[model samples]
Target: MTVTNADRESLRHGKITERPLRDKPGYPSWAIKLVMAVTGLIFALFVIGHMAGNLKLYMPAHDGVAALDEYGAFLRTMGAPLFPYESILWVIRIVLLVALVAHIHGAITLISRSGKSRGKFRRTNLMGGMDSAATRSMIVTGVIILLFLLFHLADLTLGLSPAAPETFEHGAVHANMIATFSRWPVVLLYVIANLALFLHLFHGIKLAASDLGITGRRWRVVFSWLAALVPLIVVAGNIIMPLSVLFGWVS
Candidate 1:
């Protein structure tokens, strides 16, 4: 008796399984998903931390230095005398870049493989419209987030051209934020990007949970709420900052 691909799939109940790495020509789908899950979690944690740090924009300045500025300085000088100035920050940036590249590679590869595997027949749409839509929009939302990241880096971190306001000042995080968000267009851009971030985070969290094997009913329910709540908090925290700056509430 011969077992067909359908027989194997049925036996597996559509669950993703890993094959021995030695037998594969390239990284397997499960490995790609695991890479995406881990990298996505890294990004999710970083954004949450970043959003919390940005919230210091609301704190009162001490000795003429904004608390947000202090936070920014702390990030650069973290691991201080034990390490050279900005070394820790550079290390973090390098790690984040590597993760970003791996995550993107995994997404593109999985997408290509999925498309190729679907050759002549459409898979049964068991997950319904919302999940299906989110699955489809993954690439679009991912691209939006990617563009937003580059713009954010240029506008704030590097203080580079048109993205950065004329009032942009190095090491003046609070002031720079105020100056940047004071522009309606910039605020609008931030609003749109954060909205995209919200969608991306929401779907990505749930997907990552599934990828990581959270299939128990109770756990899935818990993750569903978490998937929504985490992104909501992060996006709300981030979106409010620019809005507050734009509205003259923070400055």
Candidate 2:
């Protein structure tokens, strides 16, 4: 099709009458949502499961790694390794990996452009509606969360195996939780990370809602509240798990 002046005007207002979205780069809300929907559902479920697993701190033998290791074994036995749930968890894990990557990709793209679009008047002082803290510090907080995840997996999941003649001994989930969290340094790190995560969610989630086309009359507010609340709870919950141990609630 040949370009016409009329077609250009319509495209400027977000109409599909002349052009399709792929040819454009301005705030691909649909792409943001595609990333959100693809990743959001399963990651949400993981968040809940993660919280429950930490709650095992409230269990008996809650003093050391033994409790966590036991729970981990119980979970493994219950999942697809046993029958029904194993395949499901693996599929979810793959989906989660993709979603996380895509979500981050969309965010970076959007943020980078927003920076270019606002070049001169870009307020180093304060935003029109955005809080400066959130706008200024996303990269740092995100990197911390990424680092924490790696260390977490190494210490808990990878370190679970006992050092012997290649025997897979039961892990000490309880002891480990207690030991890891009870340490002042670890808890401090968690507290700082969770706080940053809280701020990130406060901004990113509402942006996600808008990106996902969930911005309705009242539904947006409801979801925005839930999004903020959910992260705070989980982040704080993780921090508290260790705090409890440190203060002798577990041990």
Task: Give lDDT tens digits, candidate 1, residues 1-251.
Answer: 56568657765885554654335446889999999999999999999999999999888899988999999999989998999999999999999999999999999988888777787778676686556776767788899989989999999988998999988889998888988899999889888888888888888989888899999999999988988899999999999998998888878
What TM-score should be assigned to candidate 1?
0.87
lDDT of 2 by residue, 1-251 (tens): 76577667777876646434345666575666567554654555576688778787676664533555666766655654557654655666687778778867866776776677777775665564444676577677767766766666655556643311122223656555555665677678778877776666666666566666776869887876876787778777777787877788767
Give the lowest summed-lDDT range of ten residues in model 2: 161-170
**Number of the top lDDT candidate:** 1
Q: State residue 181's C-alpha deviation in candidate 1, in Å.
A: 0.3
- Show where candidate 2 strays beyond 4 Å: 1-29, 37-44, 61-70, 79-88, 120-132, 160-170
Q: What are the RMSDs of all candidates, in order?
A: 6.3, 7.2
**TM-score (C-alpha) between model 2 and the true structure:** 0.71
List where candidate 1 sits over 4 angstroms from the true fold: 1-24, 123-125
TM-score per candidate: 0.87, 0.71
Task: Give the whole-model CA lDDT for all candidates, comma-separated.
Answer: 0.88, 0.65
